[model samples]
Target: MSDHLPVLKVRLFGGFSASYGEIPVSFGRNTTTKAMKLLQILLYHGDTGISRDKLLDELYGREELADAANNLRVTAHRLKKIIVDAGLPSHNYINIKKGIYRWDAPMPTEVDAHQFVILSKDVQACTDKVKKLALLKKICLMYSGEFLPELSGDEWVLVESVHYKNIYSESLQELCKLLIERGDYEEALRFCEPACQLYPFDEWQSVRIDCYMALNRYKDAVQEYENTAKLFFEELGIRPSEHMMQQFEQMSSRLNYKPQELGDIKERLKDDDVRGGAFYCSLPSFRDSYRLVSRIIERNGQSVYLMLCSITNGKGMPMDKPDKLEALSGELLNTIQQCLRKGDSFTKYSPSQFLILLVGTNKENCSMIFDRIQRYFSREHKSWKQYLDYFVSSVAEVDRQDSPIQFNTENKTW
Candidate 1:
């Protein structure tokens, strides 16, 4: 019946909306109504009508209805009215025969979720790599997010969402592998950006780093790794996996400095804004600075100290309250920034701790610096309950092969 009608575009993934030949269809605010649920179920199942018995159990299974069959008929009427009210030609939108109800709309319907499943199936059966890659790209990008997230609480919706999510995951993984094999690293990297946004916890950045390495974009790979690793640490309270660590180590080994003019090199390395008392950098950059400074002191015979400032409660224990820790961390950053010199640098190591590099400073000066920070913090915050603890290590004293930054998380060593 819908074969001769104009196309109806129905978007189910991410959210629900429908438009037919420039005419919009509104389900109103209450999509949880039995009428809208019926439409959703019928639209999902397509031409294969759902059995009346199964439909009743899903629609009003928990209700104490005296006449559920009549209620279903009323809902069907409402659904039909909704279709015609949307400016479409009126017809028998709900077809029922042999006690099976199906969506028989006036116009042909094309749902995004259904199209994605169909394309994924086609890609699986396709033997030609060329055609398969094209299909894979189309389908992989078709998925934006979970199916009908607004109806995620519905058990049926949850089940269907998981199915669709698995298909998206598998399709994207296959596409990335194929692209990598074809040496299309740039294209693979482009695909990874959306995947990362949709499913950030899925570690798509690892594949992205691989693509960067394949394209010899070492600088981009390192930056991506640092940003991703920092995200995992700050948000998830976790470190990188062994695989990512190994990749970083390989990148480190492959590093080589090319010949360049001193002026150009100096311009690239210069800090444009040096107004602050202390330089705050990423942990990775801080690590490089520490390594370079450690090596330099061996020739110049200078004193430097690495200090760890940890926030502790009244009982001298680590801060556990998330809100309190976050607030105090910001205050601590300000306190340390004001205490250190412009020649020094620092980085955040954890939620409640900061690692500071004290340049051209002796052991006595390190102790005085720690005292200054602690005293300043106590004076600033009138509450005066928590105290700061400091642990200092001489830069030239530690073993080069195994430096002072030795904090382990789970099975990985950082």
Candidate 2:
């Protein structure tokens, strides 16, 4: 054969060597365990030189150094021969220059683990929201299983495996949030499915509940909460958090309860003072609210009304970084909750859209509350200048008895 294609591709994320293409390539006879480990270590290190001492510590840890070094040399030699026989570039797979061993490959090769790290860094640097979302989607597609599913027992492999798993979970959460903001609830639900499988935490489950509620799938939302509640109780012998319980109640209210009782439900919605507002606030769709308001008036029942004001030039703040965003959101919610009375409720309709149900409060009181919110945000800007900006639009009130809940930029008075 005048022209022979390359035979093998070695992936070192989990452990040593193999080709996984249309036609698989195998390393020829007599590859020992130690030899394979040496190859794996080099691939895992990837272009970095591992010091002789470090290598010994990693491979033999507390064992006699003299014996380990001798064994390592023999293994490296055997690996070099295997590399050469496999019809792959083998020149400097392992080099000993001044007592340090380095892998210097002449040609670039594909390694899933290496590619994943590069992609993750790129995703972080992306400024465009849509582009960042797309890059994350691609990165997720690349994950078939854990970094190295076959090397579960290996210590080094386990470390890398956990690292990749965390990245995958974070990326999925970000994607779900993005989809939710775009009003793509179905897609958000799909993303949360696999994420909940991996994390099994209350956060992902909560997100799933939000998506279902957004889609107006009340039954599904209730079922998911029940299932998650059971899982928490059985697995950890604990009750669902107070916040989770409220969400469940709000969701159930939408299905069986009458809108006339909306006045009474407000008290339950009051959130903690430190946080901005109620954790779960349900706002009917614009069209649905129009019909709902009419029904309330026909029945001669009063409705606690809320309106969303657009925030001009308001780009959603970067809350994607796990630790920072979670803390900030918690604080904001607490503040919102503190501002309202026992009977008031608030729901996050969209990333930037919030619906506040001011129970027994008239337009004048709502204006005062709006002014307070403006001041709060203004103060937040001074301290967190780089992070916060004045993006909020005007806040107005909707007359629950006569007018439908809609947004208007023109009328400043309610």
Candidate 3:
């Protein structure tokens, strides 16, 4: 081991990062993506020394490389050079002996993922409850995020990523269980919040909802369920799992939200003129609103229009690039909210579009509303004025007989 560089620290949870002693090691622009993957594989295998054939398979997969052996050698050399240039002793750091390639460091190595695994095993194996709880807390805190979060679509990385995530989830469950049992709902929430944010699995949300309920924050618990349901249905077009729905029902049933009397309701209604910006709601909420509004409109023979505003590039054609679409979508959302009535509601249909329910409006009034939105959006997004369009659907009631609510796209564009 070199005296100056005593340790080589490797972080693999969130992304791959390497450091020697107190100095950070960076593979600059000159380094190829394959070089980084090759180094990560060696580091993951540790001193076990992966076979050259296995390395070639992982690096190239089924794709035929013209000169794979030479490519591997060059990549390994580059990996070593990256470390040597970053102030680490590189001689024998990455070596090929016989048919196996190994990353043998003279300096001590500390990999965060490896540390997480070790701490997790220690927690499981410890006989003393106090020591085990302490170790569990340590393991929970060590996992910052999923393993190699940036390496998507690679089969080798995905397998390892799933394995690490499974372990992380199990650790969180165990840690939260202990904390909650000790009446430490606040500390338990700390773990649950990150787990739900990163993973959003039913199990994590279940624990989080339980934490909020434990602290007597019933409203927060209900909101969490609503957010969870909205996320599942909006993103995947699937309902929340039965387990999550059950938890929500149990929490909501215990709440003491009393319905207001007629006089109280009248006073509350007086405060809400319901003639300004459209009500912003989640997709599920919008679905319920659509159903109720459709029934009401049918009973009263009133007109309602659903408009879909999407981004475009001056020619009234849809924009496909996500970044530009998102920027324009935000501006459109702000504009639509400002130009519509308070009784009207809108929901995000996707990153690039919105579903707006315009109440009590005929075709001409709908056109006027569209004109207002365009004018507001033009002022708010001066740069994007030439790069956006809104599609105002024909003003009609949502067909109650239709299985799924369908928007009539036969209409004018602005």
Which residue ranges in model 1 land beyond 4 Å of their true spot?
Answer: 2-4, 61-67, 255-414
TM-score of 2: 0.53
Model 3 superposed RMSD (Cα): 12.6
Q: Which candidate ranks first by lDDT, i.e. highest? A: 1
Highest TM-score: give the candidate number. 3
Model 1 per-residue lDDT tens digits across residues 44-158: 8778889999899768865789999999999998888887776778788888999888878777888898899889989979999999999999987888777877666454564
Ranking of all predicted structures according to TM-score, beginning with the best and ending with the worst = 3, 1, 2
Local accuracy of candidate 3 as per-residue lDDT tens digits, 194-263: 7776766334777778889888898889888788868754543334544555666667568744444223
Better of 1 and 3 by lDDT: 1
* Stretches of model 2 off by over 4 angstroms after superposition: 1-22, 25-33, 62-66, 81-92, 104-107, 149-162, 240-242, 257-414
Model 2: residue 190 alpha-carbon error in angstroms: 2.7
Better of 1 and 2 by lDDT: 1
Clashing pairs in 3: 276-342
- The TM-score between candidate 3 and the true structure equals 0.60
